[model samples]
Target: MNEILNNLLSLHSESEIAEFKEARNSFDFNKLGKYFSALSNEANLKKLKCAWLVFGVKDNRTVVGSQFRTNLQDLQSLKKEIADKTTSRLTFVDIHEIEHPDGRVLLFEIPAAPQGLPIAWDGHYYGRDGESLGPLNLEEIERIRRQNRASDWSAVTLPSASITDLEPAAIEQARENFFQKNPKLVQEAKQWDIATFLNKAKLTINGQITRAAILLLGKAESSHFLNPASATITWILKDRDGLERDYQHFGCPLLLGVDEVFHKIRPLKYRYMKEGTLFPEEVEQYDPYIIREALNNAIAHQDYELGGKITLVEFEDGRLCFSNVGQFIPGSVESVIQTDAPESRYRNRFLIDAMVNLNMIDTIGSGIRKMFLIQKKRFFPLPEYDLKDNRVQVTVIGRVVDMAYARKLAEYPNLTLEDILLLDRVQKRKPLTDDQAKYLKSLGLIEGRKPNFHISAQIANHSGERMQYIHNRALDDQYYKELILAYLEKFGTAKRVDINGLVLDKLPNVLDETQKYNKVKNLLQALKQKGLIESEGKSWRMSKKI
Candidate 1:
């Protein structure tokens, strides 16, 4: 039954589509309704005979059986529940249950809403932008409604496909990378021939190459699998006037085309100052580690399921912009930047893990944090992010900020990690939270509101003689007795309260108010013992310096 059911989930004969959910506990009624409306509309638009929603797959896209919420009859009401809430009675065409060996699979076979019919949820028109369910905008709704005139890329498999259709070199590279990634499977994987390897990699079907194979490892000529537009990366170099100085299209066999994109990028030398000096300490403009991490992250995590190409743009103003065709699952850039936590949802789980195991990216979520930390340490502004046009664009600034300001930031050792990140935001003239502002003020460090703050004037050298007179002198017993004796020698007396003006600022941090008073009292007693000063109680006279 398990082998028979496994055949039910294949692309060649898929009775159902697959999706992973750790538990049905996460099912939000409202969102699920929207997904049904959108996915159904997409299925209709793409002319897929049916679309499916399955559950219980893990991050590696493996079917990890899940125990669904088992008020079994309760799920039957879902189709009617969605139709009643949606506009124009839009809903699942049908919902079926299949009992597999491990667990049950719920199949929602959704018919296309209709040609030119826009599907809506709760009276709002809906559609999919990749895996997301969003209320349909006028343009997207029209695009889907008009374009449902064609077939989807996923449903197509090249019929004449064979191992000869794929690039031998690219396939070899894939095997080397895969074997290197799964060391436990080293001997098993090594013994397998090319046909066996291709099948195992999901690039082929039943030992025969398919469209996915041609796309992943095909030679330049076979890139027809990427139809309409070619599988390419376009690099555009612009001048100060926003005119394109140069443009090039990188082609197939992407195992190597990716590196060509890298070679086209140039990161220069950056100069930053550590002190109040004229010269700059030199560092690479773009940290190689960070740029590589960002680029590979874009490539690995992008929605290849969507047709848009990953983009890397080099600007004249010393910036590298990387844009991937997908929605950032983490929501906001500030949320990710300000907190030191890892991501909750990944855009492409399988591809990201593959890249991770291959050492293209590290798994611990340290790379992004390191990028911010390194830039902050160098007093460079933190990286910026923009999500627009259904794409995630990250801009990494390569220039340095003012040297004098950077110098001051380097001095403070008591600063917390969060404070450093916040200060970088502050220096960028960005808004911060109330707790963040309060934290800085409590340190007696910052003075102004919001975007403006500086080292207090009291700490600055321009405080002149007042600070010096305060900083240089001391109120110790020996110094006081000397003062008293000098007074007695020259003028014969010293006033009690007059001694208060003698010294104070030279006191150390270790001394408290009570200890300070005791020290002063002890000084007076020692002066009396040496006959250096005569305390007529309130008034004391100095004798001489001993």
Candidate 2:
């Protein structure tokens, strides 16, 4: 520790991966977190094992002493506090308190941000411009993220773990699935031994059990084989209010754990009236294939080295959210959906290969696109992917929000998947980019202004949702101008609040409260510009010209 501290002190100034802070008193917790993110990212960028955040050191290499977290217990507790806000809950590797001759120096050892995953503080990525801390640029973030493209953690063989650590039942299931995936191999596969089958299946490297093998086939007690890494999937049932109702944790073998988690979810019967049917059509709230595909994807892509369990949250309102700790390698969900080709890169090539051979996942990269297609076919909202916070969370909505919109999806068999996705965004009240809005408008598929767009009137009328269309559709600017003019004519004067009451509710429901408020303000401004109405303090009245 002394030698390490001496080396850092010998530096002329702080570098990208080494930062010196002089905290003669206490340091701000938020600022400390920012430093943690910056140093961790710099370490990854510089290909260093770890970075240094040394306290009690001035910028000039002077040890002034630090009173930050003086108490031993409080100092240790800083780990959890930093983890709570950092990406993947990453914290200090070790905090060494060295009593230097000059003062009490503290050395914070920060591990490099994991491959393909950049550390973020409080939802933002931070980095150091030499010694100065700043937001990590996109290129740097992508550079750190691309580091995992060539590496496969699951491909690494476990030296101490063997086939004995695997569960017989899981192995049997693996054989069955493998044979099912390759019917021609069924006869020959039966003759092969467990090791031979595992080797052939790519679950083992030269008959040595790999991390992928342990995760899919290892016995529950054999989880320790992947030290500092976890192979557990947690399923939680939540009510409408987001409170947990029940929860269960499943450890490897993850093949069966996927099933256990699936069964735990209650996919209720969802009944909805078809366009012209008297009796409602009933379907399962969630599709079995969708559930398995999502769960398997989570397991396959999870950054196990982060030591976090895959999470499956089932909401009573007919939604399933599957989350795993890792960056989405494909970058954007749209790229995967739009492109028909398979992904050129994968984070866990061996695990994905094993899963593919075991009939768990497909390598075609169409799994996510298939999820979206399945939801569209079932008249459900497209699967939503939240790829923020260095994690991938996919939410599958099992029920339809709009019957008309859903029927329209089935009605227009030629409607492209991209079109349906854009319409799905509209139905979900999600904001659209100008290009998306313009494309939808050019096709006459959507109506209304920006951010307040709704389904086109033709579709609404055809689907018998004219009332909903009218509610979402905005009135003409002239119509709103007339309402304001009539109000001021009858009342002589109207306050901004009074004007809001007159036209706010009349505005389209598609516009949110803020948009609605902005609409009213714009109307007042337009009328005032045309010399139709004038503002008097906070009130409005008919203009002298009018």
Q: TM-scores across all candidates?
A: 0.52, 0.86
Model 2 weakest 10-residue run by lDDT? 271-280
lDDT of 1 by residue, 222-332 (tens): 887656434666777777667777877776666566667777877578765444442357887887877777777776555554456767778877777888765576677
lDDT against the true structure, per candidate, is 0.61, 0.90
Candidate 1 to truth, TM? 0.52
lDDT value for model 1: 0.61
State the lDDT at 474 in candidate 1: 41
Q: How good is model 2 by TM-score? A: 0.86
User: Model 1 off-target regions past 4 Å?
Assistant: 1-160, 175-192, 196-216, 227-230, 273-280, 334-344, 412-417, 443-445, 451-546
Summarize candidate 2's per-residue lDDT along 203-255 as a digit string, tens digits.
99998899999999999999888877889899899999999999999999999
* Candidate 2 segments whose C-alpha is farther than 4 A from its true place: 1-65, 72-77, 80-89, 97-105, 118-146, 278-280, 494-501, 534-540, 543-546
